[model samples]
Target: MSRTLNLGILAHVDAGKTSLTERLLHTAGVIDELGSVDAGNTQTDSLALERQRGITIKSAVASFVVDDVVVNLIDTPGHPDFIAEVERVLDVLDGAVLVVSAVEGVQAQTRVLMRTLRRLEIPTVVFVNKMDRRGADGQRVARDVVEKLETDAPIYFGSAITGVGVDDLVAGVTSSLPSIDPVDGPLAGTVFKVERGRAGEKVALVRLFSGTVRVRDRVKIGDSAGKVTAIAVFEGGAAPRRATARAGQIAKLWGLDVRIGDTIGVAHRDRVRHFAPPTLETVVESHDRVALHAALEQLAEQDPLINLRLDGDDIVVSLYGEVQKEVLETTLALEYGVAVTFRETRTVRVERPQGVGEAVRFIGENPYAATIGLRVEPGPAVFRLEVELGSLPRAFFTATEEAVRGTLRADRVHDCTVTMTHSGYSSPVSVAGDFRGLAPIVLREALRRAGTATCEPMHRFRLEIPADVLTAVLAALSKVGGVPLTTTATVLEGFVPAARVHELRRRLPSLTRGEGVLESEFDHYA
Candidate 1:
């Protein structure tokens, strides 16, 4: 039996997460000497931009042995812009190490990370980093953990730079993480990361949760299946050929065309979920238009949650915050050698039909020479097309259905995908040679007439402040279009427009004289 743990290290920006990773690998003898994030030579912050900025932009993977256990570590970026990166990692994580700064204490991102970890029910251990800093206080940080994060888990103090308290932290991880019980079932795993090799062959990093997989095993992903040309176990950011990987192991595989969040083995049982949608979007432009599109297309393959798409002639990229925007800009210039400009940013919005509606495109009027009728109604899921098995000519069925689903998935009115639970179509006349081309037009018209209610992304926020500043905070919230649902002497809870969230966050500290605490999460699109 192989003893492996898929552990993820998470922290706020500048919290010394990558430093801790370096220290861990060094202590385990995986690396001889420590590399500094400041020097851009750290083992995990592999990209040039990450090294130059001294901040991790993408999640990195490495392997080290700890007390006879093989730990595959994933170091996640601390900036909120790359949160989607963190969310994807959570899908494959067996346990997580939450690195909190001893000097800064529990910051906003720390609170958000804790909420997500608890919500996902992933067992966690808190590591208080930077104990040697000028203002570092382990006890104070621990207290902040309890008061701000509301977690009672065991805490370990460590400095990623000086290597103090690292041994104890590793020991705590070895003792605290729950061992995964291998199930006797067919092979199952989730593809958490995708990359393009130098030869342009697709590579993926997968976390197998059950059964066993081998180098030549045939794997199924969605409707696509391919033989595994190669398999390698990750070691200190490198992969060495491994004949087989069993349950609870993370492996890098080749010769597979799969995207992030895709499942392997029994699809229903192993499908990965839970990704926060992007809240903002910006139009990307470059001097060489074709190069810009090509670059974005490749990047979209790496991180699908970015939802890179073309709106009219503008290529729009979804983003989390300003930090993400900066990283994307830097990556294009540094990695792809294409300097690009982004238009003014806007909050992404979605919409749902207010009521049922229908539209018809007459056979003679339309260029396709086909009469297509569609009934659009509201529902929870994205699209469900109910067409009589033989309603259309045999050849046009697949194309027609694809058109319907494709149109439904496009940005209709609010730049959000229009979801329809039930849409039915029946055309009695037999149409030949792709007459279904007009179906999308009819569906798009129907959706427009159906009426839509715009929904802006909203954040549910909790604020703790001095009782004396209650009135001032209330006024600030109102000025920012915040609606409080509940309020007490020191605590406030309410929904605020995500676009205005940054404004409120900036004002809270000054309003409370750096004593106010604010924690927020995406509640819904309201």
Candidate 2:
């Protein structure tokens, strides 16, 4: 067996994350020549849009050997808009290399990634890149990291471009970070990423935690089952053919239509938690509606969390910020050759149940062919389902439970995933067909009677500014309906609606003459 380590490279936009990846691979002799992000020739950034924009729109993986250990390196997008891509990849990482630009110091996205790394308890080594640039102060940046990120991370000063501290950074990774033993269990893995092969066959990038997976092995992803026809292991900037992949390794498996966050194997792990939900939504318009819909369906298969839905003649998409919107537009035209337009972004509305209520629909009602009795009430879980086992046959319980959980994501009230105490049915007779069809109507009525209200997600923010600018910052926060939780000479902590995050982020820099620092994370919904 080979010793292995899985790690990720994370940072803010243009902070030299891809640069660091290129330099590391070159130094390890994994690649023959160095590739530069500015020249659009980096090995990991193979996408055309990435080259055009000089930003990583998707996460890419590469592998190299260090000190007899096969190290799998995941380079993640640095933009806040694509943070979801980073969140999904977090499950596979044993540790991470957080790159901070010595010239720019600690940034908002840097702070966000640090908070997540800490929350996940993934050990990290901070690398201060771009030290050769004028005004680059590795010491000041290290101090900022400790102060803003609140982490006692071991910091290494170096420039990924100049190879000043590249060797030291590699040594730190191999020596300082301990290896993670594979969890003992059956063949269980999480599908963190997915893509389509050249032949249009579905390929799932899975992080296997236990058991050995070989070609032709039968694997189960959620309720779907398929036999793996091929396997690819990330090595030396390429995914080469592999016969088998064991626990603690990341591999690509074919023949399974697995979505991101799907559990492949016995026990299931919850989807990686994200601090903020998408607050912006846009309607997709295209001259060729049919082709555009098909294109979106394909995109949805790649990133299931986007939750792309079709509404009659229109298709609506959830967005993190403006960058995502631009990327989607460019990708559609570039990848699928589908020219599309988008409507002005609108705030995505979520629904919450106000009180308790129940609804019943029997056979021969409207177009229904089954009976469903559901009682819905507000509670903690996103959508909890309970059934009276005595009322239904044991054989049908499994199917019914799956259907209920599937429908929980979308309720009729506001088309949002609603939190509820319970939505259940009791029947002495088993329905002829699946209850999934009837459950939606019953659930919708129950939620309607429960008194649904539109709710928006909220965020808690911290702003650091000059002492003299504190009063102006307070006024700006007040204008955005922010409630301050704490106020000091130069810092203000408060909670505000997520809808106003972009405004605060945009205005603060101008208000404080580019000296203000703002950090925000999801708090709750209001």
Candidate 3:
């Protein structure tokens, strides 16, 4: 049986992720030429802004056949601001290749990505890349992966430039990666990314998990069941061709109003899973106010994670991390002819009432009444609010739940649980919708209210510096807001005390002074 592998190239920003992607495509013979990230000539970073900035602003897909096996490579943005792009792509991938710079080992964003991968339970292979660079210690970096990432990730040391160990790495991936086991029989797929055609239409890049789809094959997407009129094959930086794609293959499908994170298939729409989109939000800065909305709208269509809004005078756009924010600014200036400015990023906060509350009713200008009797209290941080229809018609439960979720989204509480309950005719009941905003206050005053806060993400950093510079390192960490969790001493013959996992972060750069090694993981929130 022929198999298709959906793999992602992930790493920290400037870890040579785009460079490695170019090399892989060139080696695989997918491209006749190789593009350099520094030169801004890479196939994936084809946008004008990307070429000028020398970084990947969005996820790009390209396919190649190696040894009769078709490999679909998704090159994702390594910067944190584009993390929403990363998170959205991860859901459709069967596996990922985590590229780590041998010289830098692991950085802050790497820890965040690894934690996300673990949470998704995706199998991964770690690529210790850039062995060609001076001071590139693959073995030491491999050890750091084990200790800091807390993974037994089998390492494949290689140089993307020289192709050394590339073959071995390929063999390991082909042999160990898991095959897709689709629950919704035959030909279901999910849209990982989307972009607008130069002519102003939407183009969806989809990954098929099972079954087969051919050009001109009618397909439905998401709960809306929108039909796809055409299928286009994409080979990077070119117009798509009419083609048929099977399970595990990535194809560019046209003629559908499909959004990113939408699932496409024949009877497989219900089984498709959506990944968590980007959380950070920001606003666009432009020299001219007239072009700001148009630019922001175009960007939002390209990547849905960047939730765009007009919050008074500022044009607001949400981002996953700082890197994404920078890319947005660059793109606005270069692509849209707008000089964009951004506010400091704020974490997406969730609020719920602390105690029990009664039903609150609000009468708007219309005759309709908005009544909600919610008992707001803290539940598990990550539990799905499942809707259960008991005696009410199943259709009613589904409709009501959809309405509740829609309300939540419109109210700007995209990350909340809501369920429909119908045990012995409960009037088509709709449960939790963690609504935010002032309207919730009117509801809370009439009912009940409570609140709890969970910060974005924290990491545990470990630095291995010369024994003589330990104190200086520790002191530096204090300056950068590093909290010292723990310290340990290594009993070597002549070396200074080696710290284990816990310590301050600011100290590492000063302690190492270009000599010591530092590592960290996603530690729990404060």
Candidate 4:
């Protein structure tokens, strides 16, 4: 029997994720006629808002056969706001086709997405799409993928427009794809994404990591020990007759009361691998109060990474990036039958008072009190502090770590950069979560307030424009807070400028006139 591979097409918004989906479908002969994302006729992005906005708002799945292997393709939204959608979909994918624009190599959102993929350990291939577009360079993009994104991914050249490199990409996907081996001793699969199906039934799209599953098989999910009584295969839009599924197979199973990070499977009854959850949440503003909840719920159903919650009068949905706010508005108005407005998304941040000596008291009847004196200060943005006590008992250390992590999560400290160093240690354990729940309500909000000290996305922007536009282009950078870190000019040939920053928002597009191209990575924040 031929094996099936589940893959996702991921990129920054307008990086041709949907366009690549259209081309891949066409190449696989799933569609007789090709549809354009701009025109909104693509099979994956059939939603009306997707067509009108010419961008993918939710992750859409479509399947095709290539090299006798069934490839289940998930086209995910590239905008940061919909990052929750990407995060949820990545749970189901065994591999990904990371589409980077030839003119714009690795971008800000791309860097964040790549980090998430690495965390998940999902194998990936880089596709440099829009190669036929003016100034397109596949080699440059491939270099950016390796250097900036730190991905050892090989580039498969392809123009989704003219089918220039589509065949090679398809071949690489089929032949070079890596296999995800099942866990050593148990049946393990992760609940990457969850959605509400027809008539309020919850459907979980699970990627089994190992072992076999049969019809009527009983499986436990997450710590809640939610069980699934029925295992059903997904056949296009309908349920399949098959009663069993195996490792590497994507199955739609019912009876799983799953959240985005939950893991579900047999054998691994007590242990669950929790995927990263969304860090930001926002309310959906709509004129119809009743419809707002339903629309947000439907959107949440489509993308579980968007954790939707009703906190009293507020309807909150988790988000991954800022651009998602706009996408949410568009998706609500288009797909959910509600015209909506969005409150400016509040970014979760972390705050720690400087020079404050704080102590956490851990006292048990066992007469074990561990206290450590500490001072709080900012650390690097990405690394977290982890303490392993060799002298302490394993259970004590575990309990302390759990307590700290719990405090941090409840306090939303993960939203900011944290560094923990050893201060002097005493008998009483002073291990408690610190620096919780910061906020950045608008631009220019202090990086400290945002719980994120500014870390600018760096890009080696390759622009191919008329030579006459060079002066206007260079000047536009200053207006957008971009410093021309490096510029190489050639007469009549245009310019290739490389810029570095801690952040780029609204300025990159404004400087480029939506015509000049750019791509960037998260270079370390200075």
Candidate 5:
């Protein structure tokens, strides 16, 4: 049996990543011929709109065997609009191939992808694609990649269309890239993505890192449990039921109602997510208000980061950018048959705890009949019980946890650690409801003491324009509250409110006579 290597192929728009995926599949003899992105016949670009637009909108998975390794190639969208999809796939990749255009040199999204890959420490191979194009400059682009990426990644030159240098890429995957060995340890996995069955049942896409999942086994699904009715392993596009899915394999498991980021059997070993959550929100309007919310809930099940909720009478959905907003509208209309319009989008302002804080409320002493003490600190996002688990009735503990989750669910600010430092009860007077009611108040007071700093979402931008338009661009930046971190002769890098990005994009063309190119990504809240 061949070992498995979960690999991700990533690139910016038109970087030829989909073409490279075709070449890799064909090289492995998975397909008889190559598929073109423009022709819309590529195996991976399966969505209708994807074919119409000639770009990938969803992450596609295909399998091939290369050098005793079952290479599970996950093709991710290069467009900045669908970056949330790419971020979801990144959590499961053992390694990645970052495709760069030899002609375009290094792009803004390329820099973003590389920066994230490096930060995650996922072993990467940079493929300098479009080597056969007119302005292809492999040597210069190689230097540029080195300077911009600051990566020691093994670089290969290739034209995905012409199939040159694919052999070297193949060799690099086995030699330079990393792979994990299967283990027979305890069952451990993570639900990275979720899909719906024909009957609308939840089908979970789980990456098993160890042990085995067989039919009818009641296994842990995050904090809940579910019986595995069936299991199917990925065979390129087809998913046929299998007896069991073992370690070091990806499987589609049925009969599990799960959400993204939920762990199966054991704790997930992957690091905390590196991608920022959506910072923009829009109010959705639909003729059938009832059907609209129900459909939105179904869509949210697949990508929970979209954050579907109701604001008074209007339904609101969170999104990453304008592109995501458009995609959400299209998916709802095409898949869910829920056609809707959206109001103006706005930034999602959030409050973050400024420092370590502790607050306690005791029965009789406070307005509540429960005693709960909590400590909040600026750290990794986690909820821990510093107090013994058995101290309170299981229901009271559960209620306390629910209170914490609800309070933090809408917080888009930086992560903070919550710890239950103390807990007590006056016997019958301390009902589960008492703790649940007091937990939030105590936590809020702790947050207040820690200092509530409201922050608006900000985008880190890089602007390149001609020197002649420097004054005009600088003046334009000032109007939008752009603060340049570094200003060069023609390049300006800075942070601006996300709401100003669209306005800046519109002004760039006239400001630089259509020569100015601006690239920005959500950096942080301030």
Candidate 6:
């Protein structure tokens, strides 16, 4: 059996990471020539604005063979603005190549990425690119990388443009990095990317850990089920249009309504959301509200974090910050052709169930042909089925539970497990759509009975400052709703409102006389 390695190449902006990707592909005979970012001809940076800006925005995939193993190369965006896209792809990688610039050394985003990689324990190989350019200091840059990122891995210095030291890098990846031997087991695959085909069908880019998925196979995709109408394995041909996607392979599968971070077969791995969820919201208005809404629906399907919704007369979009806002506007105008304007941004408060409550609706009594009994209470599991699993058709159960979670997510609630207290359906009259449509109503009724406590989502923050300025830093943190939990010498740690983290980061420099360093990530709600 052939082995495979799902490798990711990640870096901060302008580190020649994309150039390194093009070089790797060309060296492996995957492409005829190196595609230039400046020429707008790179293989991975496909977006129009991405090409214009000479930076990657979307994660791209290509396969290359080395010895007996097939290496699946994932080119992720280097920009902080597209960190969501990058974050979505990180879990799919078996190993990663962290690209650092020889001249610029380790950057802010580079440190962030390095921390995440270390936290995840993803085996990483650091590559120092642009060694051929003037002002490039490989030794000093290597020291900086060690000092900043604190990684003990070997760093390869190479000029991506000149193809020098790249062969060594490839050798390091093949030898030092892990290549998993595919094992036999129940079908377990992860959906890493979801794209709309030309015919508007969802195309799932899946990384299969075990078992095989062939054409026309009915598969369970997390909470949903669908037939695999077509398959294109990434191992062979310029594009393998139809083939069986087997274990240890990546493939483009059609005929599935799935999302990124979804398990395609059995649960391969639980996708942990580490980044702070978007709580900043703004209103979008257009001349054609219907068209604008339709476009946003499509966009939101691709990125669930957007949290697009109807807020009375306005359409609200939840996002991270200004850069994401600009990207959304650009995507709307360029792809959907819907010109729009945004209203004042505001903090979106989240809620948690304060008490336990149950509500039940019978089949004949309910307007819909499905009966759903829901119990809302404070817990960890987001959605749990208390009743027998086979009480209803799997499709109906999936739909109802999916709807329950959707409604809760739309309402911006945290840490509440909704249980299916009871479920019933009319034999001939009932359908999955009926249960899906009724679920939200029953869930909301139970939530109302339980009541809730609105909370401001917070971030776990760590600040390093000079010992002399600790007092001043502590005072500054208090101004931004920061709760300092602990102090170790000059290091302060605590939780702050997620929305105000950026504000604290902005104020840290002034508070500590430019000697303050702060790092924060979403922690919990208070």
lDDT of each: 0.81, 0.81, 0.63, 0.61, 0.86, 0.86
What is the descending lDDT order?
Answer: 5, 6, 1, 2, 3, 4
User: Which regions of candidate 1 are displaced past 4 Å?
Assistant: 181-184, 268-275, 385-387, 393-398, 412-436
Candidate 2 vs 3: which has more TM-score: 2
Model 4, position 163, has a per-residue lDDT of: 88
- Please, what are the lDDT tens digits per residue for candidate 4 over residues 345-400? 66433343222222332233113344322222344323233454564445444444
- The sequence of per-residue lDDT tens digits that candidate 1 reaches over residues 225-271 is 98898888775446788898778878888988888888887663544
Residue-by-residue lDDT tens digits, candidate 3, 1-526: 4456778999998887887778778877778887777787888887887888787877888766556465677899886556667777887788888999999887767777787788778889999998989999988998889977888876898887787877787777777877543233566888877877778778788877777777666676755655556677643323357667666667777777877777786533443323344444555566787788887777776676566766567777665556677776777777767786766666543343344333333334212322223333344322222333344455444444454444444334323333221122223333223222223443334223334343343445555666777666655655555666566441111112112223333334545666665554333333
- 60, model 4: CA deviation in Å? 2.8
Could you give candidate 5's per-residue lDDT for residues 306-415 as a string of tens digits? 78876567788887777777877888889878899999988888777889999998778887778899999888778899898788988998899888877776445357
> Where does candidate 4 stray beyond 4 Å?
111-121, 138-152, 180-185, 226-241, 266-323, 330-340, 344-347, 351-526
lDDT of 2 at 274: 58
Which residue pairs collide, candidate 2? none
Per-candidate clash tally: 0, 0, 26, 14, 0, 0
> Which candidate model has the greater lDDT, 3 or 5?
5
Clashes in predicted model 3:
26
Using TM-score as the yardstick, the better of models 2 and 5 is: 2
lDDT value, residue 387 of candidate 3: 30
- Candidate 6 regions with alpha-carbon error over 4 angstroms: 132-137, 147-150, 180-187, 216-225, 235-237, 355-377, 381-406, 417-451, 466-468, 488-490, 509-515
lDDT of 6 by residue, 1-526 (tens): 7788999999988999899999998888889978999999988788898888787877888888989889989998887757777788887788999999999888777888999999999999999999998999999999988888999977999999999999999999999888878778788998878888888888888889999888999998876889998998887324477658778888999888887888877987778975557768899999999999999998877787787887678899987778778888888999889999999888778889999989988888878999899998999857787889888989999999889888887787778988898988888889999998899899899989999998987888878889998777878788888999899778898988887888888887887788777877666678
